[model samples]
Target: MIEHPMIETDRLILRKVTLDDAKDMFDYLSDSEVVKHMGIAPYQTVEAVHEEVEWYHSILKEQTGIRWGITLKNSDKVIGSCGFLNRNGKHFRTEVGFELNKEYWGKGVAREALEAVVTFGFKHMKLERIEALIEPGNISSQNLVEKIGFVKEGLLRHYEYTCGKFDDLFIYSFLKGDKTNRKSEH
Candidate 1:
């Protein structure tokens, strides 16, 4: 089984999500603005969030992926979640995904959490490449990925079907020896 370790940053804690986190997860995930670029629709109920958390746990048990609940160092409230999705252990590659509460936007919290997650993926999970797929209209997320040193590869036509329609996506990637990954060592 893959061990899910809690990762800490200067101001945030990234740890396993629990059933108790449903309310917090639902708080942000229910926002249309937040789920706009995501594959899933805005959560309608806390029960739905509970189901989602259960799914996250199942994925961890299967060793398919790991999703960490992001919280402030001094609080138990989950402000967001970030982690590797579609992890391919044999190829040492995975897709990175994260979402933060709208209230926490523009505070650099997402960037800090992502940096720690990326570092953990490379150093602990031994990932060779971390990729991100973002909607063309999500400029904020696009900027965030680029800011973290992921190179924009190309636009994938009709890459994902979300919110009842097919959407194009931009693919960004970070390799093992990339300068940003190297700098993450410290």
Candidate 2:
């Protein structure tokens, strides 16, 4: 199993998932509102949450997608998750996805976590493109993608069939050398 190195940013730390995080994972991941747009459904119990965490615990150290538990510096709490996934092509492209605890809604934590993951993908992992497939009407996530310079490619009509029906996914992307963040003074 190949392990992914931990990553850090100005205010967040991206670490591998462990079964010990079941408590924090259940807190947010079991919320229907939070999981509504996610690929996975909201967990029904802490046991269910642990089931999900266990899978990531194995995959995080394997050939599978890189998943991280997003913890904040000030609180040291796992507010949510964000990571690289769904790799394709000559190991040069992958998808990025994330979710947050409702308690942190309206905050810029998503961007902080996202930018760090994107930086890891490009600057370290060497991926050529990073994509986000957001559910329609998820305006908050849509705005976050655009703010980070990912252009709306188009709507992926019924791109995914989940929760017993077809769901439209918005395809937004950022190229490898997009120059969107090259001007940063930091």
Candidate 3:
């Protein structure tokens, strides 16, 4: 089994998610605005959130990926999550995904958490490429990735079908050893 480590930032903790976090996960996952560009429908029940949490566990067991619950340093409340998924060991690459509670938006919490995750992907997982697939309309996410040094790699038309329709996605990537991969002055 792949060991999951707790990653700490100045104001947040990236720890292994547990079923106890269901309510907190539901808070953001249930928000339509939070999940608007994620393709998945907003969760409608805590039970669904439990399953989502279980998926986090399964990925680790299968050695496919890792997901962490993002919590404030002063509280256990999970305001968001950031992690690597769709990992291709043979190719030394993986996809990154993250979401934050609306209440914490624009606070740099996601960036801090994501930077930690990206570090883990490159250092711990020894991945060479970290890709982020985001909907074209998700300007916030686009800006976040760009600020972190991911270069825009054009678009993938009708790449995903969700919420009853197909949506296009913009692909962005951060490769290992990129100068911008280090702590940014911003």
TM-score of model number 3:
0.96
Ranking by lDDT: 3, 1, 2
**Per-residue alpha-carbon lDDT of candidate 3 for residues 1-186, written as tens digits (9 for 90 to 100):** 677899988899899988889999999999999999989899999889999899999988887789999999999999999998888999999999999999999999999989988987888788999999999889999999998899999999999888899899999999997767447323
Candidate 2 residue lDDT tens string, 1-186: 576688777777888777778889899998988997886778878788877776665656554568788888776667798886677757588888899999988878888888878877788777888999999878999999898889899999988888888999999889987767522424
Error of 2 at 96 (Å): 0.7
* Candidate 1: RMSD to truth: 1.4
Stronger candidate by lDDT (2 vs 3): 3
Clashing pairs in 1: none
User: For all candidates, what are the clash counts?
Assistant: 0, 0, 0
How far in Å is the alpha carbon of 78 misplaced in model 3?
0.8
Task: Supply the global lDDT for candidate 1.
Answer: 0.90
Give the C-alpha miss distance for residue 156 in model 3, angstroms: 0.5
Please tell me which model should have the higher lDDT, number 1 or number 2. 1
Q: 24 in model 1: Cα distance from truth in Å?
A: 0.9
Put the candidates in TM-score order, highest first: 3, 1, 2
RMSD of 2: 1.9
Q: Estimate each model's TM-score.
A: 0.95, 0.91, 0.96
- Measured on C-alpha atoms, candidate 3 has an lDDT of 0.90
What's the C-alpha lDDT at position 131 in model 2? 91
Off by over 4 Å in 3: 184-186
**lDDT (CA) for every model shown?**
0.90, 0.81, 0.90
Error of 3 at 20 (Å): 0.7
